[model samples]
Every structure is written in structure tokens, then in C-alpha cells.
Target: MIDIVYILNQIDGVLYFPILIIVMAVAGLYFTLKTRGVQIRLFVESLRILFEPSGDESSVSSLQAMLVSTASRVGTGNIIGVSTAICLGGPGAVFWMWLMCIIGASSAFIESTLAQIFKRMDNDGNFYGGPAYYIEQGLKKPKIAALFCICLIATYALGFNLLCSYNLQSTFMDYSFYNPATTPMIIGAILAIITGYCLLGGGKRIIKVTNTIVPLMGVSYVIVSLIVILVNYYNIPAMFALIFQNAFDFQSIFAGFAGSCIVYGIKRGLFSNEAGVGSAPNASASATVSHPAKQGLVQTLSVYIDTLLLCTATALMCLSTGVARNAAVSGAPYVQSAIGSVFGTAGPIFITVAMVLFAFTTLLGNLYYVDNALIYLNRKNKPSKRFMNIFYVAAAFIVFIGAIIPMDAAWAMADITMGLMTLINLPACVSLGRIAVDCLKDYEKQKKEGKDPIFDATDIDIDTKMLDTWY
Candidate 1:
């Protein structure tokens, strides 16, 4: 019997190992150089712009948009994903994850800036855009844009959401009363019901939920990680040494590049921060900023927050506890075990609660992107209210289905779909990247003149006729 799930994993591995990694690295480096390290040079500026008011109650603020994106970025990937990386790829994977964030932030800025540059507005005074809008408007390729939108819908609505559901349910396996079959179905029903309520209420409801949950959950998780670090202060120095030592083992890296620490770190890091993968731009395009670069910079900071802060917090909590790292304890169990080493019975309970919050917010956040993609696909003849309601019910059923699937199968499905999305998005970003670069220059020139930067599409050579929001 040929196991289909095993084939999926193998295919995902081949897709990512050298080809995806090389393209992602080159694209990140290209953006980093083109913007002259915008991620670092404008770090403080990004922070300043993050809290700026939207100036319209109907429009999302920079902070709210960031929270919405962060809700998706900082999900189970920050918890179970990090644990899985360390377990399979060694502690050194943490170092590579950090490295990817630094490079990938620049890509995040470029894609998001382009998203805002070409965003669209509906009659209801709401904003929506992503790779699809930018590709069609900027690249003048509506067909490719449609393809990208289809991939986006599949990646977020079906693939990633399912993985999140599975990861959330996996946390309960340690409890004494857990039944592998019944517990997953029960938890899935509860999660699906809650998610369906939010989805049917539409985009505003989704934003409200993520905005409230992201900040509270992030702060609480960071505080808990701090406690874990303090308890294992004695082992901190050794942990750093181990991470670096394993990170730079060239011989091991060459021998098994696909299964190496670098590969796993990059894979999970991209999953967590989602910088170059092109997901954040959906939320970035929603913000009502005076300048596109402002939201771009804000999104760059979001990458740091997701990976550098939240993901690192998870990695350190696990490593600092000196927990055993191997396939047998990967995913949620590994994180639970690591924390349990420090807090005993209370640790697993805390992780379960955290997973619920993280995965739930992620589910909503992912659906938010799905809404954007659906709108783009249906721009010709807008989807009916009844159609959207049916879609919501169908989406909830997918969540239930996700909870019952095998873990490897769920993750492989997400990885392959996400990889496809990245392949489509990266090229479009590179082609339209010059516009983003020009936007940054315009922004900086205004800053130098001691004035607030406001975008004028005419300032750049791009066709402004298609930029509905800018006018």
C-alpha cells in the first residue's frame, strides 16, 4: 500500500529544500538591497507609524491592521511549529529562523507597500487588496492575478486553517480523559461553531475579534516565556552556544540539506512570520495610511514581532528547559513537555489555553484573507449575500474536517499550498518592486523636508487610473 500522506510530505520536502529556499533568499536579498535595508534603517520610523490614528472610524488604523495580520502570523506556528523545528532540525534551527526574519522583513515591506499602492475601495468605505490586485494593476496581468487569488484562497481558507485546527486539537492528547477520536470531533465542533459565527458576521466582526485577542494573547505569552527564561537562567549561556554550534555545522548541512536545520528553520520561520510568503499584504492593504510606505514599514515590524519576539520566545522556553528534542516529542507535545518541565501540571494547561487562543485567532485571521481573495475573484459579479452565507457554512465544515485528519497530512497540505502561493507572489513582487522602492524614496524625501508624507500616485510613473483608493 502506497501511503498518500507520506508522498505528500516527500513532495513538500523537494519543493522547499533548494528551489523554494533559493528563490526566497534571492528575493529577500534583492528587496533588502533595493530598499537599502529598509527593515533596519526605518525600524524606528515603522514603530512611530504603527500607532497613528486611521482618522476615520470606518477605516482600520495601522495598529489594528497590524494586529489583524499578527493574529495570523503569530499562531500555532509560533508554538508547535517552533517546537517541531527544534526537535527535527536541532537547536541551531532557531538561529536560521532569526536570520530569515532579518532578510525577509525587507520583502514584507515591498509586497505590502505595493499592496497599498494599488488597493481598491468598495462603496461601503472598506479597503481590500493583496498580490491579486497588485499583480493585475501593476503588472497588467489579470489572468495571473486570478491564479494567485485562487492559490491564496486555497492556502489560507483550506490548507493553513486545517493545520491550525489539527494543531489546536493535538494539545489535548496529554489530558487523561482525552479520546483521540471523540475529543477531536468535540473540539472541532466547538471551534467550528465559534468560527462560523465570526465568519458570518463578516469582515468587521473578524477584525474586532482579532484586534482584541492578538495583543492580549501576545503579551500574556511573552510574560510566560519570560518566567520560563528566568527559571532556567543558569542554562541560558549554554543554550546560546548550542544554537550557534549546531547552526554552523557545514558538514551536516551539506550531507542532508533537505532534512537539515537550515531547511526546517526556514520552513517554520516562513510559516510563523509569513514575510515573503505574501499573506500580510491583505491586512496591510486595509489600513488607511497617508503613504503606502508607512503601512509597509509597519508590516516589516510585524514580521519582527511574529518571529523575532513571539517565535523566539517559544524557542527559548523549550531550549532553556533543556527538553529532549526528537521526532517522538515534536509539535504540541514537545512544547507542552518543555513548559511542563518548568511549571509541572500547570504548564500543559497553560499551553492548551494558549493554543486555543492562538489557533482561534489564526482561524479568523486566515478567513479575513479569504474574504479579500473571494472579493477579488468575484469583482465582475459580486457574490450574493446568500452565497457568502453558504460559503461560511462550508468553511466551518472544513475546520471540522481538519480536526480529524492526520497531523502530517494536514501540515503537508498547508506546506504545498503555501509554497505555491509564494512561488506566484514572489515574482510579481519582484516585477513591481520598483514602484515600492520609488514610494519609499518619496516618503523619505518628505520626511527630510520636515513634512508628513502623503502619497501622490503621479509622483511615480505607474498608471494611477487603476488605483481606485489613491485617488
Candidate 2:
């Protein structure tokens, strides 16, 4: 497993060092300009739509879909991942992470808006679309779409959920409440059962669970962070100063942590908000909206919530408590120590409970992508619900097994696969982004006229047939 992880990391270095970095950065910059800075311009309006109800009862609400994606985005990455970033890269990583999310929001807008524009009806009479659907249908590249979906499955299904389960198991086992030996299996089974409950109940059931759990977890985390921040209010300015000053310390002054800061921070940031990784669009596409850009804006807001709100909270907790200064910071321990500084033993327990809530919901959310991916992968023979049930059970079992064992190798593999998916999706977004641009223009035109914007497929010159709902 260690050998495999080593190999995967090597692969990741080759792919990302020059290629993925340039594409992701340049495309993010391109779209931010191409779209007239929609994320910034529409920030207020986007928030309003976020709280607004899903207009059609038949389709998932925009907020529910956003939460589903947020469920995945705001996971252990925000907590343990932040700890690792700071430990490895120094406080400056937080600044780079924030930068990634800000620019990546534009990338998210392009993919999600395209997903909405190209969404089609499944045989089950449910809405489904994503990077694969849009790449094949909108970009007219079936072979690339097929390749992309396979990587998506590898990244999310075979890799991420399993890692989430393993980490969840470890988080539970770390505490006094659960016996270390038996706790992992017990937690894994419990996760499987709960996940099966959502999966068997179908998409709406998944939506219901995410809509309920994700917000509660997010709000609770924010409240906890606020308490911690206020407790250490005097340290706030200096902590931020460390962040900004070290952010560009590419010299001997920062010593060992110089270049590492940017690398880890950007890596963790990409892992956290996942704005351009193409997963958010899967959730965004499920929404039934008058205009495709509505969901795009909602997803863009997710980037801000994930990084600016959640990740920053985690960083603040670590930095303010001085826990981040540890030379070998890793995983839940760093966060637990930070919380412990302010709240004592309650910190670890709070984090343990939060991990279960955040990671388990993420497990469910990752499954949603595979569920939609299965639909795109199996167009000829529409999957019966029974088949999907079997698939879900297998998925749960895989997570269970991964949880019961070590998952570091699988985690590394997932990083590589997820990176590939992002690279593939970014190019597609760059190409098909014009559709989103057109949709944005149409939506803005309607808004300026004092009208509730509604999307017409023809407005973007996309075949109405590709967008089954728009007619």
C-alpha cells in the first residue's frame, strides 16, 4: 500500500507540477474575466437565491443541492486538512487557500452553469447531468466524456468515500467513548446502514438528509469557531499578520516552510472547496431552476462558504490556539489540541462528533455523484432501482472494508484521480464556458429588466432537446 501511495504521489507531481496548475489557474483567470466577475458582482443576489425555496416541488431545491455539494466540500478537509496545511506550509497556506477558492469560484460557475444547461431526463423520470453529460452533449465529445466518468467513479466511489469512512472510523476510535479495536467496524456498519437508508430512498431522500445534516453541521461548526475566536480575540491581529507575512516568504527568512506553504495551502484549498474539481456541478445539475446560472451562483456561493467561512474558521482555531506551530501537525489531533486549548477535553469530543457528522454526510454526498455517474455510464440500459440498491450496498460495503483497514494508499490514489478529473473538467469548462456566458447574459438581461429571470434553452443556442426541462 505504501508503495502504491508513493507511485501515485509521483504521478500526482508530474501531472500537477506544470500541467494542471497552469490550466486550473489560467482557466480560472479566464473565466473570472470572461463572465464579468459574476461571483463578485452577484454576491448579494446569489445569497438571496440560496435561501429561496426550490420553485418546483418536483425537482430538488437549489439550497438542497448546494448543501449536498457542500456536504462533500466541507468535510475533514476543512478541519484536519487545514491543520496539515498550516503544519506543512506555515500560516501563509491559509492565504493561498483563500485565493484558490476566490478564483476557483469562477471555474465552478462555468461548469455548474453548463451542467444545468445540458441536463437531461433519466429513464427514471429524474433529472441528472454533470461534467460527463455536458462534455459529451454540449462539447460533442463522447469518448472524452466516457473517460471522464470512469475517472470520476475512481476518484469519488472507489477512493473518497472509502477514505472518509476510514477517517471517520479513526476519529471515533480516538475518543474514550468508543473502544479502539471494535469501534471502527461498528462505526463502519453504522455508516453503511445510514448511507443505505438515503441511497435506497432515492435522490430526494439523499436531498432530505443533506439539507438537514449539512447546514446543522456547518452552523454548529461556525458557532463553535466563533466562540473560540472570541475567547482569543486579543491574538487575532497577530495571527492574521503571520498569515499575510508568511504568505509570500519564498526566501530564507521563512526557512524550511517557504515554498511548502504555497503548495500545501493550494492543495488543501483545492481539496476543501473543490470549486473546479467538477463534483459540485453534479449536485448543481439536479436543481430545477428557471435559469441555469441560478444554480451556478448558488454553487459559487458554496466556494465562499467552504473556504472563506469553514476553512478559515478551522485555520483561526488552529492559529489562535497556537496549536498550528507544532512541527509535525497532522490530522484530528492538531485540531483537537487547538480546541482543547480553549475548551479542554470538550474539544476532542466536539471534533469527534463533528467528524462523524461531516464525514458521514460527505460519504453520502460522494455516492450521489456515482449515482448520477452510473446513469450517464449506462444510457443504453437504464438502471432499475433494485440494481442501484445493490450498487449502493456494495459501495457501503467497500467503505466498511476500507474503514476497517488502513486507507492511506486509497487516499493517495484518490488524490491523483481527483486531480485528473479536475484537469479534464477544466478544459471542458473552458471550451463550453461560452454556453454559460450566454446563459449569464440572458439571466442578467432579464434581471435588469426587473423580471424574475427564466432560462430559455434557445437563448444560449443549445438544442432544447439537450435540456429536457427548459421547453
Clashes of each: 0, 1
Q: How far in Å is the alpha carbon of 431 misplaced in model 1? A: 0.3
lDDT of 1 at 184: 95
Model 2 off-target regions past 4 Å? Answer: 122-126, 172-214, 252-259, 324-327, 384-390, 404-410, 461-471
Candidate 1: residue 178 lDDT (0-100): 97
lDDT of 1 by residue, 275-321 (tens): 87889998888899999999999999899998999999999998999
Off by over 4 Å in 1: 201-214, 469-471
lDDT of 2 by residue, 1-471 (tens): 367556766786666666766787899899999998999989999999887777677779889888778878989788877877787667898998988888889999999898888887676666678899888887789989988888888878877877777777766544666776788888888887777666777556655665676678778888898888889999999999989988877783346532377767877788788878999888888887778999999999889988999999999988887764654446677788888888898888889888877887777768778766776778735588788878878887877776776544645655677888998899999888888998999999999999999887766676765555776
What TM-score, over all chains together, does every model reach? 0.95, 0.89
Top of the candidates by TM-score = 1
| Global local distance difference test of model 2 | 0.80
Assess the local accuracy of residue 308 in candidate 1 as a C-alpha lDDT between 0 and 100: 92
For candidate 2, give the lDDT of residue 128. 73
Clashing pairs in 2: 89-261
